[model samples]
Target: MENSASNNILDFLIHLDPFDQLPRDIVATLASTASVKYLAKGESISFHAFCEQRYLYIIRKGAIEQRTPLNKLRARLGEEDQFGFTFLAPLRDSEDGYRAEAIDDTLLYLIPHEHILDLCEQHPELHDYFAATAKTRLDSAVRSIVKKEDKGLFFRSVGEVASENIAVAKHTDSIMTVAATMCGKQKSSCAVIVTQGEVVGLVTDRDMTQQVVAKGIDIHLPVHHVMTTNPILINSEDKVIQAISLMLQYNIRCLPVVSDHKVVGLLTTTHLVHNHRTQSLFLIEKIKYANSISALAALREEKQVIFQALVESGVSAEIHGQVMSMIMDAFTRRIIQLTEELLGPPPCEYAWMVAGSHARNEVHMLSDQDSGLVLDDNASEDDRVYFAQFATRVCNGLAAIGYPLCSGKYMAATPKWNQKVSRWKDYYSKWVASPEYNKLLSISVFMEVRSVYGKSELVDNLQEHLHQTITASPRFLSALTRDAIETSPPLGIFNSLVLEKGGQNSNTLNIKKFALNLIIDLARIYCLSAGGSLTGTEERFQYAVKHGTLSQASCDNIIGAYRFITQVRFKHQLNALTQGNEANNNIRPDEFSSFERKHLKEAFKIISELQDVAKLKFVQGP
Candidate 1:
């Protein structure tokens, strides 16, 4: 029913991002309204304030170079790429230097600026897509992908929104007295039971009604007799969503907030549900109750949806990483439990430890499995066999459900990694003592480890031993410094990007390798040198600054750089996913707008400066 030219335009629009997300009717209307123009080689089109008509230009068949009035090349755009965003809004000055010149005989589709404005008015979200700067468009693209939901309140901290004036009672107090205390304070529905300033239990009105009155228990009994001992608690600084997740997971109506082991406040489901949506909380609950591997795997898609929502809501990278890591922890713990049931219980105590990003609580969608098994020293050969088989099932099951196996085989299934407590200490000692190239790789991966399941003391003891050894050996830290700075941030003279040469990712930057990893390594060096055990990169930097090992100014600069680079990387990955492409860290320079280009160059400069600082402080001789 359509001509070949119209069909061609429609096809092109359907494949590009933002446009790809538009309704079919909108695409059809765009195709109907678009006007075509041809430009000969070396022909230039200049936009100025006096032009009565304005247009959004899309290159249809050839290359176009955008330049400033000073004739500096700003960007190169090809087929399916667009420009002329200034025309979408009114201009104040004619000096705004933007001109497009065709590199060859070029075909272009030009849509009137008024049309774009009309569409933006009809769909308010599209305004970001048509924004004048690349950063704005990129941000808008992220926001556009998320379905509309409750936005406010999720980002607020639990302590800020939680009820601070909570009823408190001693464990020795009578149940009737505790209930009277709660009633006298009209705002309190729950009473926290404490003994010598430590929260020992929690008693709610429901608990009193159900456990006391319904069971015909004496009201004069001490609250501890009817209280839920060792009740789950949340730190005062935790996010509101975390409280919601905890409540849903444990089926508890309320959680006591604790700081310094003392109850500070109370957070109930009523507080969270009053103003926030609990999609992430409910999704985690679904993950917990998932009956089979297939059902668990299906929930992986839902995880992406929640991730998109969180990113769209504009939460910081730290929060994003924390939420993602919590989800991964939930998945890993549940999978281990399921595997244990299928393979039968272990013969000895063992700790399932996660390393790298999961341990640092910095997980993203592309995070792979980096886990190890720490067995009790009492384990025999038979115990090793059973644990090895169990580890295989857990690792294989994780791969089946979206998380791929580690390319370096750092997972628990590897016998070399699955070891007794003493053996793990020996491994750390050997790695730290030698500090060889290959051994440094092992140390870097295994250095920041956290126990996800089983006896946590096994992992804690190993961590303490590692810190002691590293602190005692300055040569090892020097070697680590050398290793950290070996791969410097890719920056060229005159503020250009130094891209990978002649590989599959040629002309693209490996963001993880050149930018993110450098910041991570610097953080690790500073923290380890200070004998600090913090894992999160930002926190590590802060700890070093707090300990006077690193300057606060340098820490702030590096952290800002780290956050920007991470935000850009995440947006790139999000864009790939939105377009149904496999998400990766390889980003083409042309994909970035001029604004993003400027900031990215600044971030790379900051990383380069920090690498030199590390080299001066640790790598060079005194």
Candidate 2:
């Protein structure tokens, strides 16, 4: 190729992914060695391990359609779309033979496989882009986005932010001595007590005040008596996000940071709050300490700001949802406590459960309340009335704090959903035993209930009953599978009526209704069919793979698709918020770059393929 022509090719390559992620000089090298081919309409190229030529094909100006050896259509590729990733790998890893035929006169640039192999060797990060799996490509895409953003301290190792001033004491140390150590030059708020060089317990300033001063216990007593034994510890090498997750999960204020089972430092809520990068991420702590519903409501704007930060930070969707869900959980729990305080404690035992997206821990900006109440079976009529008012206040308070009330009334505030244990079991029994089509919608909302507050055992009992009843019913999964496949991802972007009117001429894509929910619903069917009780969509699919119900490859493909779709939705919503518009699921088509449009089509295809497989696998079963 001439120098000017090579430069033009380099320009196009640099604008594409993987190449765009590469250094310009390297991309220029690839471009200089690239070959261009023009395929007339109806002309084709066949790919297989045995083929002498293996090159990554980039469609420059036209459309192409890939077909399997069985002559079934594989994918439709447009300009900026690339194919033949499987051919870039070793022969043993290549996909089955496929043919790519030109649907229009196509101008294609072919990057020699050997050159890409050399590129991968030089830049190991680029390897994922050439892997035969969508999972690899999607993972690489996420990493690329995160690498571009201002990664927050959440991405840093816990050791970086931990205080090395942790007071080290022996298990046999007296309470008075440990307290003295905490107040010494170290000025530590916590102490790690060890026995035989192993961490055995943890003590904090609160323990000293509460155990010794408040109770006037013997100051000379061994610290072990008042210390929290078998205390939770975090690895120094783990990311700050893991530390945050641990603190939230166990409701702890401090963690002993260990290296090779040796106490190295201490981390506390105080340490986290003092850091600017992570201060705003702890809105859950604020929610917990809020004095009233008004105070919690005031923090709602802060929640949005934290959400924007999370999106900008380019964290994975799972972590993003987990953080948001934790915030929601805090809000709900605090609201329930305030409601109980005002209305007086419940007359009977109960569990406050969340359903749908919240239950799955997939809460986003648009998520609303999908909750229920399971009361103790022996409650009286008057007890029911008191509990009814209690739940109403909690639900309304949640609404006041930015969690909208469920439009479908799948909430504890609804009398039909707030019932005794026996009634809840009966509802599950009726839905599972008969497996009627219309009844599935209501049951599906509560398909994965998680006890957010109160007695968790009550919720566990209901989950066991529901799972057991589902196992006994033969047609329930088939019904769920049928319902799942009722909607298909668009064969093309707009095929599923995925587009809503953006204006007089442009159209917007309803990403949730058309995309995210499809994956969520499929995950539920797969997990429930396997008798697995996992709730999160990604984990449920992995559970399916673990139990031999789904292939690992399929699991990877689906999860990768789910993650990509979620990123699209979140980034779009984040963009909307930044632009002062209401964050929503509807995204305009023109907003997508060539890169996004191409990957989105791949994601849509994966969902469509999985839906087909589910229909055949579950709906066809006896």
- List per-prediction Cα lDDT, in the order shown: 0.79, 0.85
Q: In candidate 2, which residue pairs get closer than 3 Å at backbone N, Cα or C atoms, i.e. clash?
A: none
Which residue runs of candidate 2 sit more than 4 Å off their true CA positions? 1-8, 21-29, 70-72, 491-506
What's the C-alpha lDDT at position 141 in model 2? 64
Q: How many residue pairs clash in each candidate?
A: 0, 0
Q: Candidate 1 residues 1-622, lDDT tens each?
A: 5667767788877766567778987887887778889999899898776677888888788777666777745555566567777566676632365788987789998888888888888888778768654345544433433334634566567888878868999999999999999988545889999899888999999998999999999999999999999999999888776676567547688889988787888988777655434554456667788877777898888667767666665566777788777788888888888988888888899999999999999999899999999999999999999998999988988888788999999999999999999999999999999999999999999989999899999999999999999988888888999888777665432123433222132577788988898899899999987889999999999999999889886887788777777777887888899999999998877787544554565566567667777888888563
**After superposition, which runs of candidate 1 have C-alpha atoms over 4 Å from their true positions?**
1-151, 156-201, 205-217, 222-225, 228-267, 270-277, 493-496, 499-505, 620-622
TM-score of each: 0.67, 0.93
Poorest stretch of ten by lDDT in candidate 1: 494-503
